[model samples]
Target chain A: MKIEEFSSDHLDVLKELMNIAMGNATASIADLLQAFGTMHIPHLTITDMDGLKSQINHTISADEKYYVTKQLFGGIIGGEFIFVMTDESAANLGHYLYDVSQPSDADIMDAVIELTNILSSTIISRLTEELNTKVQFFAPSTQIISGNHIIGQDETLNYHKIIIVSTEMEFQSHKISGYIFILARDETITRLRELIDQKLEELYA
Target chain B: MKFLVVDDSKLARLSLIKTLKEYEPTAECIEAENGAVAVELFKAESPRVVFLDLTMPVMDGYEALKLMMQIDSNAQVVVVSADIQTQAQVQVLALGAKLMVPKPINSDKMLGILQQLVF
Candidate 1:
């Protein structure tokens, strides 16, 4: 089925599934940081690469430098998770995760990668478990960009249409926030549609 | 037998209302898309119990809970949200929430919540 063919029932089920998965992931993050965090409702959208770029533009402002992390998860339903956080947010993460008042550059990168792994692995793992699928995660990479340098500029993502599952996570007390984008392209979209269909069937039946 | 169901997602509202009806078949449920409307409904309708979601557009559950408590100290609001952080739980309880549970409320969980309610 085409991405546009997704019905309201399908989107609702998908959003609920995301809520459950993200709930579990947020608990893990809270435990890791020993702090409280809030997750926004998961937003599902089907868009081209340019549209994805536009969303990133809308989410991550051009005024501040950001440390963007990307991790790929592969299997029948494979996709990449992109996490974007401002430089100050990254530093705050380092401090909170490691209790370092003045975290170095390496400290910031390490903290970002660690946080990304926790967020992506817990979320995707729970989501796949609900879908009855298995996935393998690759090492994550981080890049520092400022002033109009978006994260999705990689030439490899040339798909005509992609599914973007996006959310925002915030630790209000710590003043740290990040935007997470999970991109599923081509075959992955088809697989997601099938999985969602099965889920809807189970729910309605 | 009046209850307020507040969530931005129609699916969540439907799911919760469906589960709730199994326990209280004659329960009247009022729905709201966001916290702003929820507060208004709480003021006007005065639902016996409220099932609120934390992460929403316009206003969030935290502010809504605070307002509801200010309007009526005895208001019963159960926070159903994706944010399961311990601090979130503490924050809501401190704000006078009756209970804080996670998303996707099923029949069994709904029964437990209802059984615990004093009203």
Candidate 2:
């Protein structure tokens, strides 16, 4: 099914669920830093690679340096979760989590990976559970790179579409606002709709 | 005069409390981060009403609701979650939720529940 074929009801459900999942993720970051965080209303969309990149670039250019983290998950459906932030934001986060104002490069990377692992796993696992599907995720990996390096990967899943589920998270006491995303494969979109429809039947019908 | 709100998000819990305050200015609220803590709070405080989130770490709402039932079968639980799909609602109802309230809650819904729970 084409990405546009996804009904508004299905998209709404995904958005609502994503809001909570990402809220949980933001809470993890808060606990990591011992500070409160605020979650922006999530932006939910479905598009091809070019559109996805364009949407992201509308806010921050791809060429800008960003700390990118990635994790892969598989089960009834599969997808990649990507977290992005400016280099300065990453450093601020790392410093806060490490309790140092000027952490070394290695310390920053360690903070990034540990932070990403917690945030990514929490969001994806919460989302999958809410959707009533079991999923398994591998260890997360992080790098200080550009956003282009993230959406620029080639996939062998034979899927031409991705569900771009994203939100901006900001620390209440800190000046760090970053992006968190879940790019679900084409097949995963179909499966998600099926599960949602089944859920609709059980609740409304 | 007491309510228990269980959610992993501190922001969300605060939001719920804000809404609950509209109708229950004097009602006491106890917060829990997960189902395990929720069960413990239910034992310690015995709040008259509960607002439970279904997808939480440690133990999910389903298990929490079941255990709460075992402890106090009369507990009035309103399942609060973003996962309000029909299957989710049915499951929570089967697990013994009095009603299901989706996340991003507002005052009207909370006032309604407060009216029912209080008077």
Candidate 3:
């Protein structure tokens, strides 16, 4: 079934699964940074490229410069993971990750990519394990860009429907925050829906 | 006893309620989709205890706990949120929550929380 065909029960179960996955990533990042952090509840939506862009733009301000990272994962269930963080947050992350007073640009880039890797792998692995599936992740790419351009204006989205599972991670003491978006489309959505259905059957049984 | 379970996800609320039932077979539950609704229900239902989730749309558990305490100083609130940061736990407790436990509550954890409550 397509994303629009998802029942309320399916959406609810998927959301709870995302919550558990994101929570695991939050704890992992907290340990890496040696700081306590909070992860917001996951927001799941089915939209096209334009709608996804609009949602991201609404959540992230257009005034700041951000470090945007993207990673692709493929298997029975596959998707793209996008992470966006403010430039200032990236710098703070460098200091927190590398313990440097004034980290150079290389330090910032390295830290951002590493952080993205940790978040993507932790969240995807946890989610896949729960769904009884496995995935292989590709190397992530990072770029410094304006917040407005964090999500590229590529209208050439391959799929007619996109499933976006997004959340925010914040560290109060470090004043660091980031947004994570997991996008899946095409056949993956069908597989995911089936898995969610199986989970629902188990829940109701 | 009557319990109030608050969460944006119906699955979460259902799971918590099921575990609560396992702990107390005859217990009654009232569900709220967010902290705003939880507050309204709190005033109307006066549930014996509340199991709250911190990150919810419209309103969050922290605000709800603060408001609940203001309305009834003796309110019993246990935050069951995925945000397990130390700061989050301390903040909820400072706002007068009886305790803050992580999400996906099972029967044993529910039993522990129920036993920890005086009334």
Ranking, DockQ, top scorer first: 1, 3, 2
**Relative to the true structure, how large is the alpha-carbon lDDT of every model?**
0.86, 0.78, 0.87
Q: If you assessed candidate 1 against the hidden native complex, which CAPRI class would it receive?
A: medium
| lDDT (Cα) of model 2 | 0.78
Report the error of model 1 at residue A149, Å. 4.7
Please state the error at residue A18 of candidate 2 in Å. 0.7
How would you encode candidate 1's per-residue C-alpha lDDT over A145-198 as one tens digit per residue?
A: 873675444556656688889998787778888988998888888888899888
DockQ of each: 0.58, 0.07, 0.52
User: Where does model 2 exceed 4 Å of error?
Assistant: A1-3, A153-159, B1-117
Lowest lDDT sum, 10 consecutive residues, model 1 chain B, at B110-119
Tens-digit lDDT track of model 3 for A1-205? 5567888888898888888788778888888888888668788888888888889889888877889999999999999999999888999999888898999999999999999999999999989998999999999999988878876666686456888999898888898899999999878888999999898786666
lDDT of 3 by residue, B1-119 (tens): 88999999888888888778876888889999999999999999999999999888899888899999999999999999777667678888999999888876877788889889942
Per-residue error for A47 in candidate 2, Å, reads 1.1
Best by DockQ: 1
- DockQ metric, candidate 1: 0.58
lDDT of 1 at B73: 99
